[model samples]
Target: MMQTLPTLKKVTTTALVLLGLLTASCKTTPATQSPAQGALVSAQDSHIAYQGRIGHAGPDAAELYWSGTTIRLNFEGTTVKAWLKDESGDNYYNVIVDGDSLHLLRPDTTRRAYTLTYNLPEGKHTLELFKRTEYDRGKTQFYGFELGSDTKLLPPPAPQKRRIEFYGNSITAGYAVEDNSGKDQPDSTYTNHYLSYAALTARHFSAASHVICKSGIGVMVSWFPYTMPEIFDRLNPALPESKWDFTKYKPDIVVINLLQNDSWLVKRPEHDEFKRVFGTTPPSQEFIVNAYRSFVQQIRAKYPDAQIICMLGNMDITREGSPWPGYVQQAVAGMHDTKIHTLVVPYKNTPGHPDRQEQQQLANSLIRFIESNISW
Candidate 1:
């Protein structure tokens, strides 16, 4: 009787097992299921999703996006790979990843777009693509995460800070030059050139430098269609609605080079277009003097504690052209408690531009000036 009962129990167990197998055959792999909403690639778990934005202009503003997640970035490699478009030829960007100390990377080719790659550790990270220059008027480009591995990338410990701020026109911006190691020939404007005088000087003094300059822009004013009085309209337009908010970074030393651009408009011939733009009779030497004074005054208002060094005569001025040293002298004449210095460049490289030799010379002169005059 007991054996018969045991056999019955086995039969029931087998029937249930057969039913479970049939049910399993009706299901599919979870991987084949639809992607979850706002799903992103995660660095932590290979299965979890990530969300991040691409374009960043503020201390931590969104400039790019990939379903809204920050990507891990590093700088221990050569080429930085990014998925970007080539629609406009002038949309330039800078990369900031928490690397050795926040490495700012520039594109190496004219391929319209590229991707940046690096080996990083495992952890939460932030990748920011910042719009640096725009050649066209209304062309807009956005960048963020296109690709990365499943492993989380970790950032190194933050380094100590030594900061310096530089202000001027195109020259200070490394305009029309190549990378830091480019040959001495004029190519295109590369604000990435670290060999430029300002960068070199900053490196020599072991400090980090920030650039706040645009091509064809000056302080007391700018060229026609826009004058010194109209700069607030132009430079101020790039700024956000807040007063203390500007590109989100402040520097200790701000070396200004606006006089060169100002000199062109102020010293034009008696019947030149600049004279017409000002709606005044052609300016005498006195007009130039007064203009320089006003420019210095505006700079002082913006950066009160900054040690302002006014630069003149870059690669643009010819030997016989109007001397900027004299103009700078007049601007800082009555100012006190301020350490105002002047630099006169005697050589240039590009056609109407500074060559490598001249750049080295200018760098030497400026380093000496910085050491002797400004408190590094």
Candidate 2:
């Protein structure tokens, strides 16, 4: 009783339509705000420079996000307020000022302005706001920043030389990397994409990073109904119909860490509960290899000149003689593409996913690989 592609498509379409209606109804009405103690700056103001996949950038507001996307501004002031549109309770962000320290902030389910900081000394400072939550949480719209009357915004920092894009599942999303609770567990409090291997690797190379990941998602199969191939191209991750133009931003390198979920789910015992959920038996080896190869080819088509690295492990898939890594290798070889390569990271993390320390180790290995194989 395998679900046919058309049946799956119909179900996905119906679900998306229902979700769209519900989201539209739940949209938080925008709130009016008096100008801050100083100058009122719109999102399009000269001082505010945004770096990431901005979905909608109007004169007054801009939708900013995708994990690791950042917005930066330099100003001379002791306090600043940001106007944001928050529709879900899951949107969280990190506000860093003058590189002093990290401050985590979560917006309420209301469209209004919020004070980012108000206790700094009255002097020149730099502020960077990063979306800590992944795409699945939803998008945040930034209306503008309000500064003290005497404060003035400055130009942004120089752009990074290299840029990398990561595609994968919860591991790439940095799920529970911070749990350190000494127990194998999954909790939102412990998930921090900022500390994931992709982000850390980008930091080591001083490169701009973009993380496109969803927990339980895989290249060939997923624990959920949707897979990466079905949603990776969406401009609005939550809205499947929103298509993202690939030419807008190009990465120098693309790292894909997928198939782990597929391995975990597809290898389930015949009597496993997932068999009833997925309505199909384990996919054949040929099917998995072909699916992976096709997905990589799709990426190659999008980024023809960029170097592609297919990575696996730091999970059960990394065990000796694991068929997971072999599938990736075979897929690469079948591509007949020199730019594609493979790396198998040993499983050295705790019982569950890799913790922060393990993420750092993986980042180090990836950095070494990039330095050796790629020009930048």
lDDT of each: 0.44, 0.74
TM-score per prediction, in order, is 0.60, 0.85
CA lDDT, candidate 1, residue 335: 67
TM-score of 1: 0.60
Candidate 2 structure quality by residue, lDDT tens digits, 1-376: 1111111112111111101001111122222332334666777655676766777755567886577778888887676767677667576676777765466666655655566656577677888788867776767888777775666666657778888888988888888787777674564556778788988898888888777888888886677667899988877777888888889779999999998888877767563435654456667788889999999999999999999999986888888878888888998999999899998999884588888888888888888898898897
Cα RMSD for candidate 2? 11.0
> How much does candidate 2 score in TM-score?
0.85
Considering every candidate listed, which one attains the maximal lDDT?
2
Clashes of each: 32, 2
Superposition error at 346 for model 2 (Å)? 0.6
